[model samples]
Target: MAASVQIVDYVEQGQSLYIQLKVIDAETGTAVEGEVRFLGELLYGELIHEKKSPLADPVRIETIAYLKTHFGR
Candidate 1:
């Protein structure tokens, strides 16, 4: 199985939310595919899944928030 990550959102210093991620192949230490799964509730209380695939060179992707707790609430 390949390695994967789940990113909820990306809130800038104090701005709107966005998505970010990186891709890597564990076995060969190479760049692989990157996926972003956005999960949230709608006004009617329905679950939503917004997936994104970004093709680019290897780079570090991280959320703007210093800690996950900061966005848990």
Candidate 2:
């Protein structure tokens, strides 16, 4: 089954933006209630810098792809 993601919230603290995401199984549309954390930088509403979290790799990748596709680089 394919997976999908939704942006639940965005919070800015200092120079970092904390993204909260809801990851769902596409076929079932049921959310995976897992907490993932990522550290990244955004410039002028665009994602210009990024760092990764080992525990949240999949979610982080999805979030970055989503931001780049919808919000631009």
Candidate 3:
């Protein structure tokens, strides 16, 4: 029963980038563990990129910092 998702980590393989997220349950205010369905998309100009994750959990904050730096956002 997750109400929202938060970025947990970002990974790069070759030329592709991947983002990991944590599903948060609104009722308990805690992250749901184990495999969970995930769908995400990124839009750049006229092109769109999509990704999915079956299982995701918490990761170091440094991962998020890296993403911010890499994306210059």
- Which candidate gets the maximum TM-score versus the true structure? 2
Residue 8 error for model 1, in Å? 13
Minimal lDDT window, size 10, model 3:
41-50
Which tens-of-lDDT digit does each residue in 29-55 have in candidate 2?
Answer: 456543333444333222212452322
Best by lDDT: 2
lDDT by residue (1-73, candidate 3, tens digit) is: 2235465676555544555555554545655433221123231211011233222222222323433454554
TM-scores of all predicted structures:
0.26, 0.44, 0.30
Query: What are the lDDT scores of the predictions, listed in order?
Result: 0.31, 0.48, 0.38
Which digits, one per residue and each the tens of the lDDT, describe model 1 over residues 1-73? 3323344445443333334434343444654333222233111101111222232211222221222333442
Can you rank all candidates by lDDT, best first?
2, 3, 1
Off by over 4 Å in 2: 27-30, 35-38, 41-64, 67-73
TM-score, cand. 2 vs. native: 0.44
**CA deviation > 4 Å runs, candidate 3:** 27-30, 33-73
